[model samples]
Target: MHAPVPGHVPADRVFAFNIYGDPRLTEDVQASYQSLHRDAPEIFYSPLNGGHWMITRYEHIFDIVKDYEHFSVREMQIPRIENPPVFIPLSLDPPTNLPYRQALMPHFSPKAVSAMEPKLRAFAADFIDEVLARGECDFVHDIAARFPVSVFMELMGMPLDRLRDFRALADDYFKARTNEEIGALGERIIGLMTELVELRQKEPADDLISKMIEFQVDGRPIALGELQSMLFVMFLGGMDTVTNVASYTYRHLAQDDALQARLAADASLIPRFVEEGIRSFGVINTPRLVVKDCERFGVQFREGDMVLCVLPLGSRDDRRFENSAEFDIDRQALTHLTFSSGPHLCLGHNLARMEIRILTEEWIKRIPRFSLKPGLRHHSRVGTVIAIESLPIQWPV
Candidate 1:
């Protein structure tokens, strides 16, 4: 059932699109989102999720995300909760958010990510090897989910033994419904992070967490609150986004024999393939709080109202991408809001790209041919992140 529309929202602008549990997401997530572009206004209000605005067009999303002055990042979640979990830099607006983001740049920089490529490649190959002999496997669970999580665990110095536990928590957090459920899961996550922070404080190690604990923001040592917030966001990013993207992209490749052969034959095209895949199957829905009453994008946005930037829709916006729906590896000037844009642009994009590139390169090098097991209908779940819940594929033994 839809929530009552607010007085400020025009009747034409109200569209009951539920970002979290929309039925169409399970059938075809990207196509489900694309329908909004055809059916709804560029910017409309959704009576679901406590009545918030949905920004479908690319230009408007770009402008709103960058305009921190107008659209604040303070309360990003829809169906607004009391005292939501804090994600450092992400939840903080510009100027205030800048220093924390700057401190993180060197760590996630192209150079730093390059340094980790060997380990990333090894992790990818190892996971591939585990499933390669079987000739049939659930790609999403067997490889897509485990690979990046393992790499992230190694980077953060988390124990491999707890990989499943941590992954489960991350999964639960995303799938959680209701404010209380989300909050409870968030606290449990923070509880885990708090332990790690305390342990790192006592025994400093050569890891991302230890390095971050040493970061100084505004000429002062980062406080515990800020440190926990940074780690919290890192945990979420490290665990989920890449996994979803990998599943979606591979599912696409599994269906298209020609595209799979092309990438397998020419490893050089793998990078372009990664870029195009991310653009085509981008999986993040970022929300922003309308800071002050404003008249922009030809609509009225009241203060404290939440606005969700439908990021995947932005990448597929025809105004920016020619033949945006078609997945063309040769598409030139391929820029997208997949990693978002502006001050809060995703910090881990370099690592995410490298992980996906290496994994694809390794998979194609080994299992050069594979496809969805016949008659298999993969399941998907959509929330802040859209994911293929299961993907069974097979190849010649």
Candidate 2:
């Protein structure tokens, strides 16, 4: 445990332990972000893990990510790893990342994702109908979480029954405050993935996992350990992220009747609104290592130094937009760093958009009006990825 350096986060703010715990569930996270921006402009050091620099400014973060040569994603802390840690394509730098990414791109291409839309929309409709019939429900657990997790499972050919288990494992692994807690959950997920990988190897199927099993580099298959890590990363990353985006977007849209009505009236605008929602609800801005001693935002950093980039803050940067803080669905010429900027930009971005688009459209078509309960409480967990535990909303029959 690290102590906060007096004035570490600026005079106006107090740090919230779970800023990423479940981004949609917490209110204090916004306060912490505001404090960092208003008082500590360039960077604020977190007391977590003896502290690491958290960059909130837009240009500062963009500059860092854009110049991959300066900031490397390699060597990032992955919950339960020791010296000479396990790293996958996501954790790899340029040349190494390029091949694996190329090998996988054909699977997530525009044509490929477009082909998935019909199946995804069918899934979305069924998911929405389940909640709409109830008249009221916990959006996160019942609907938001279910849709993406199920879709990903179908895409990956994982047993749909294990969706809840996977979520539980991922939540545990990500929200673990202690190393022991993380290790216990992480090892379990690895075991499960390993079993699935072995089973798929024995009798291949027409799924993403099977495809990975079939993919080769230099006339040999990609290693099973790396494949398991890759799949695990995809599972956890996609599930919580889509869930948070859905929950936050619902919360934000419901709060402003005018905005909600606008979206409800114009279904065509749902996609744009979803993009803005993702931007505003920007979850994780993971850390990157300073490959070599370098100066960023005028601050000198050592070779092995770490830097945290908050995507939401960067999305709300005034330098990038006319009004960064204000939410504008119709805001033309909007460019946000929520998905990040660079080679390591989210690979699932297209799929994420498709999921959100299908979800929002189907949701509005069914339940066009809703509001938060008078005294609903939100639960947020801030970790490497921010998430929403539950989003409670109500609608008429």
Candidate 3:
């Protein structure tokens, strides 16, 4: 049911888009978003989720993300919660966010990600080997989900034995329905992270957490709250985003025999394929809180309003790209907002790209020809992030 549209939202600009529970999403996530581009106003206010604005066009989203002065990252959740869980740097703006972001840059830099390529490649190979003999596997559970989590575990120096438990928490966090439910899950996550923070405090291992603990932010020692918040964002991104990206990319490849064969034949094409796949399957739908009264894009904005930048839609904007919806690896000047734009642009994008690229190269090398398992359908859970719930895929032995 739609909430009452606020007076500021013009009658023509209101759309009943529930980002969390939209039924059409399960049918075809990309198609549903494409329909919005073809049908809805460029900037419409969805009455659901506490009456927030949805920015559809790439031009508008790019501007809003950069204009943090008007569109604050603080209190980003739709249906705006009271005392929402802090995600640090993610939830901070400008000079304050810059320090923490800078502290993290070196670790996720292209060079840093390149140095870890050998180990990452090994992980990809081992994961594929585990499922190769079966000739069929639920790729999301058996590989896509585990690969990135394992990489995160190694980086954070977390015990591999707890992989399943941690993965479960990450999954639950995304699936949560209400503010109360989300808050509870947040506490559980923070509790788990707190244990790791305390452990690094005493032992001081050579893990990412240990290095972060030692680094000074803005000429001052990082406080405990700031540390946990930063760790939370890292854990959230590291554990979840790439997993969904991999699943969606592979699912696409499974259907496109020609595309799969081309990539397998020429490994050099995998990087471009990865970029195009990211563009085609962009996952995140991030929210920005309006800090002050403003007006733009033929609409009026009130202070404290929530604006959701539909990244997937923006990347698929027809005006921005020729043939925007199709996943064409040969597409030139590929600039998609899958990693977002501006100061709050995704910090872990380098790591995410490397992980997906290595995984694709290894998968195509081992299993050149594969497809979605016959008689099975794929479904995705749409919330802050769009995630494939399960992906059953098979190949001949």
Cα displacement (angstroms), candidate 2, residue 85, comes to 4.3
lDDT of 3 by residue, 153-222 (tens): 9999888889889888988988886888998988888888889989999999988989988879989999
Q: For model 1, how does the per-residue alpha-carbon lDDT over 28-53 read when each residue is reduced to its tens digit?
A: 68866888888888899989878889
lDDT of 2 by residue, 1-397 (tens): 5555444234323342223342333363443464456655466555556456678888888888876787888756522134423446677888777777787788888889899999899998987787777788888888888898888889988999888888888777767756566567777877888888898989899899888888786567888777877877777776677877777777787788887788788888888888888877887767787778776655666665557788878887767766766678878756677778787788878888899899888888888888887787786777567776777888899
**Model 3: lDDT of residue 160:** 84
Lowest lDDT 10-mer window, candidate 2? 11-20
Q: In terms of TM-score, how similar is model 3 to the real structure?
A: 0.98
| TM-score per candidate | 0.97, 0.91, 0.98
Model 3 lDDT on a 0 to 1 scale: 0.88
Q: lDDT for each of the candidates?
A: 0.89, 0.74, 0.88
Per-residue lDDT, model 3, residue 213, is 85
Q: Which parts of model 1 have CA positions greater than 4 angstroms off?
A: none
* Candidate structures ordered by lDDT, highest first: 1, 3, 2
Question: Candidate 1 has which clashing residue pairs, if any?
Answer: none
Q: After superposition, how far is residue 254 of candidate 2 from its true place, in Å?
A: 1.6
Candidate 3: residue pairs that collide: none
